[model samples]
Target: MITPLIHYIQEHATFPLSETDISLLEEAFIPKKLRKRQFLLQEGEVCKYIAFIVKGATRQYTVDEKGYEHVLNLCIENWWTSDRESFHKETPSIYNIDAWEETELLLLPKANGYYERVNIIPAFNEMRIKLDDNQHMAVQKRLNMAQNYTADYRYEELTKLYPEFLQRFPQHIIASYLGITKETLSRIRHQHLKKAS
Candidate 1:
């Protein structure tokens, strides 16, 4: 039942886990699934779990003072998602996490032999390095978008980067993730069509 989980982890990790380490993870990790658009965490709520996506897509987003949503990330299959500030510091979250499609995730308890058990696993440090790398890359990407790109270029980058998203998520959510209004996204799409003609 957990072979998919193990395979996903192994594929993503730079260091390999031993059979015993794999066995220990299967015992310690709690598995779950959420239907499309279900909330995993809401703003002002405590994030109680760290999740690795086993399948499907989820997003972490913030609601503005005017109650408009601004998406931060879209976590696809084999990705990890969480309200990091809340999950790590054990504080109330400033963001909400929800599924974009029917999703499966492995929820690891903060207390569930996390570092202590996984430290013995060869894959542990590899996982940490990747996580850090992803976060750093995300920051650089966002900065580039803010500093150098037009909204249309950003939209194009997104489509190229995550084309599968078009079939799964609504336009407004994608627009928010791109830091543009839906109207702007519509205009951008129109421009793209014109150029392709």
Candidate 2:
């Protein structure tokens, strides 16, 4: 379970990790498994841990007054999931995070000195910085798309960037993630298929 995370750190880290660094990481991250549809974080709860997905999928979403879920993020293998604001500020989250499939995660909790302990590793520290930068960029890109792009264009961009999502998640979930109605997504898919044909 930790192997994937170790590989992820190695791939993203600016420097190589020493044996002691690996031992520190092993001590910091706790492995957990979630059944499909199990909640990782629920609305109104403070997020306690930042989860790194080793296998399977998860979604972070919010429910409206009418009880319709709007997906804010979809995460799969090698992706990190957390309500960062809730985790950092110790405030309640408006979002709910759940497993879309039986998921394996390495959770880094705030309770212990885990963060400070891991930060001693130069490679882990650099990886954390890189993750923050990439997350910021992704958020900005998603916001720009939501504000300026058409539903068709958003769907196209999803296909280009995360084509696996089309296969892994349901149409309704994909539509919610794209901020479009399922009907509209269906129509767009039909049109794209026609063009491809």
What TM-score fits each model? Answer: 0.91, 0.98
**Sliding window of 10 residues with minimal summed lDDT for model 1:** 112-121
After superposition, candidate 1 runs with Cα above 4 Å error: none
Candidate 2 residue 193 Cα shift, in angstroms, is 1.0
Tell me the whole-model lDDT of each prediction, alpha carbons only.
0.82, 0.94
Weakest ten-residue segment in model 2 by summed lDDT: 111-120
- Residue 59 miss distance in model 2 (angstroms): 0.2
**Residue-wise C-alpha lDDT for candidate 1, range 53-106, written one tens digit per residue:** 888999899988898998888888777788877877889999999988899988
lDDT of 2 by residue, 1-197 (tens): 67888899999977998888888788889999999999999999999999999999999999999999999999999999999999999999999999999999999998888877887788888999999999999999999999999999999999999999999899999999999999999999999999999
Candidate 2 segments exceeding 4 Å error: none
